[model samples]
Target: MEETINLKELFQILRKRLLMILAVTFTAVLASAIVSFYFITPIYQSSTQILVNQKKADNSIVQYNEVQTNVQLVNTYSIIIKSPAILDQVKKQLNLDMSVQELTNKINVASEKDSQVFSVTVQDAKPELAKDIANTTAAVFKEEVAKIMSVDNVSILSIAEVAKEQSPIKPQPMLNIAIAFVVGLMVSVGLAFLLEYLDNTIKREQDIEKILELPVLGVVTKMEEKKAAAAAVTKVREQTIGS
Candidate 1:
């Protein structure tokens, strides 16, 4: 019985604030759509694959040792790929306006354990620029690897290709709209309860009767517009006649 009464109150509050909830939900969805589609800039990602292969040698033992050495160097090379030393050359070679530090931030390098392949990913507002950055960073790293590590173990496995239909990863419209809708709904519900709590106006007959501890005789319906106007006119005519 208590739970049912609380549920009824909840329903009443929702019913009373249905319009505000809908208004807030609609506004939030619209704002999310607008910002996601028109205002936010799209970011494009491009990735290049490089192979960290061991240098070929005549001796089997030397080859095995070299492979192990290359595998161990993978983690170090991953860091070097994103370092300012390599990225600075990439920037200079590409004639990019971004600083080495900024370029490093935009680039990501990763390699799997025991795998010979590593991936270099770069993200930018322009798709072509992203691709160019990825490819150039890989090329710069490959050329300078021997100088940095004194081992020709790094090789360009695959160049970064311009994606046929690159999609932006950021400003996901559906996700943003969904989150906004939920947040708006929550905020609307909170505001509705707050307003209902703050409202001290007696809106129900029961409330008035309860406060006064008296039974209501009958409900007086409000007069219709036409009837109200007719009554006013009649009263004015009677007053004029009396005067």
Candidate 2:
């Protein structure tokens, strides 16, 4: 019974503040949509893939050990691809205005473990620039790795290309609004309970009972002036009869 009553009270509190919660949630979603669509800058992404393979020393077919070695080198190659030697050349070839560190920050290299193929992804404000950066970085890395590693095993599998209709990869307004909706609902519900907890003024019979730990005896109703005069006379008459 106590658990049911507590649940009822909680439901009542939430119901009383439902409008406030909805309003807050709506406001939060609207703000997120506006920021996502207008305030945040869109970023476009492009990627190029490169393959690593060792050349056969003789006419005989390549061994599995050599293939494994090439796969292991992918980790080192991923690092070297982001190094200054590769990025500096990439910057020079592209005539980019950014520094090597800035260019490095924009590039991402990823490959599955034991995979001979790796990818270089680039993000920029412009789709063309992203495509150019991805392609140029791969070309420079392929050329420099041969000299640095003393081998010609790196080969370009694919180059980044701009599509006829390109789209940005970031600043998704729908996703932002969805996140805001959940966050706003949680915050608003918590705020409602907090406000309810802090309110101490007694406004109901149950509040009085809970505070006093006693039952209410009776309620004295207020009357108009004419009704008060009539009641006073009736009280006197009843007292006279009792006497």
Candidate 3:
């Protein structure tokens, strides 16, 4: 036979297991809060911006073609900034004990659409280190690009500086706790429905009729012990008085 539950049954099941659901959700949020605040390490990010434009003399007006060429060159420069030739030098300059691939993983390069300005962002455990890496990477890329491409178009628009009050970019405790709470609520509600579905004991006349597919002839009413005893005593008194 097919079985289905309506919205009322679903609400009843959830209500019956409301305590369990609340407990699980609370535990999950607490665990997430603890891990996010105490166990996970915070990572800091720093970014530097560079402008890609051809170097022109003071009296020369910039040409349209040159501007377009510089815009296209930004893409190539973004790739070269993460290359081993550039990052290796950055690592050496910073005296960092990290490989080229590891350093590259910590760095990100992005440019705006149809724009000549690009940004280099670096992430590290130490705020100072992150700032240093961003600035050094930009400097090294600028110097190397001039030698490799025979063009001095890259100019540092802004160098990364360590923030006075540094805040980590990762390990957002509130967000983690919110996600955990949602997951826990879903799991608990699903478990409640599964448990309800697995229960097969007859609890009412409707249950027996539904499962057995037969008409219920009658239902035996259960009397309270005090009421039954009082009725028996009254009947015995009547019989004694009649005798």
Candidate 4:
């Protein structure tokens, strides 16, 4: 015979194991909070924007063709900013101990769509270091691009500044705890169902009837030891008083 469960049984199962579920959920949330706050390193980001426009002669108005050319060159400049040529110079200028690859990993360059403006962002453990790296990278790239491509078009629009109050971009404690809470609830519920399924002990007459395909003829009532002893003493007292 096949067995089926209903909503009532599901609720009963959860009710029976509610304490275990809550314990697991609380444990997961606590572990996530601890790890997020203590173990992970915090990263700080600083960014500077640079404009790629052609250097025209004295008081010359910008032309549409020149704007289009600068827009197209933004992509090339973005890639060049992370290259060894620019990164090596940035490392030397900053007196950084990291290699070209390590420095490249810390820097990112991006441009606005269909625009000649691009930004260089740097991330480091120190907020001041991040600001310095961003500004220095833009300066070094601007100076080197002119020599490398023979185009004096790169200009710094803004330099990154150290923030008075900064926050890390990674290891969000609340988000991590929320995710762990969800995972813990799922695992705990799954384990509850698995334990219920594995338990084969008959708990009621209905269970016995279902398993054996037989009707229950009778059921023996259970009696507590104290109640049975009291009843026996009363019967003996009544017999002695009648005799």
Cα RMSD for candidate 4?
A: 3.6
| Best of the two (2, 4) by TM-score | 2
What's the true lDDT of residue 112 in model 1?
Answer: 88
Residue lDDT tens for model 1, 115-203:
77889999899989899999988888888888977878778887877767878888789999999999989998999999998998998
Q: Model 4: which ten-residue window has the lowest total lDDT?
A: 1-10
Clashing pairs in 2: none
RMSD in Å for model 3: 3.8
Candidate 1 regions with alpha-carbon error over 4 angstroms: 58-69, 205-243
Q: Regarding TM-score, does 1 or 2 come out ahead?
A: 2
**Which stretches of model 2 miss by more than 4 angstroms?**
57-59, 220-243
Please give, for residues 1-243, the per-residue lDDT of candidate 3 as tens digits. 123557777888899999999998999999999999999999999999999998889999999998898889989998999999999899899999988999999999999988999999999999999999999999999999999999888899999998789899998888999999999999989888988899988888988888899999999887899999998999999999999
Report, for every candidate in turn, its global Cα lDDT versus the true structure: 0.87, 0.92, 0.92, 0.91
- Which scores better on lDDT, 1 or 3? 3
True-structure RMSD, every candidate: 4.0, 4.2, 3.8, 3.6
Q: How many clashes show up per model?
A: 0, 0, 0, 0
The global Cα lDDT (0 to 1) of model 2 is 0.92
Which 10 successive residues of model 1 have the least lDDT summed? 54-63
What is the lDDT for 236 in model 2?
100
The top-ranked prediction according to TM-score is 2
For residues 111-141, write the lDDT of model 4, one tens digit per residue: 8799999999998988999999999889889
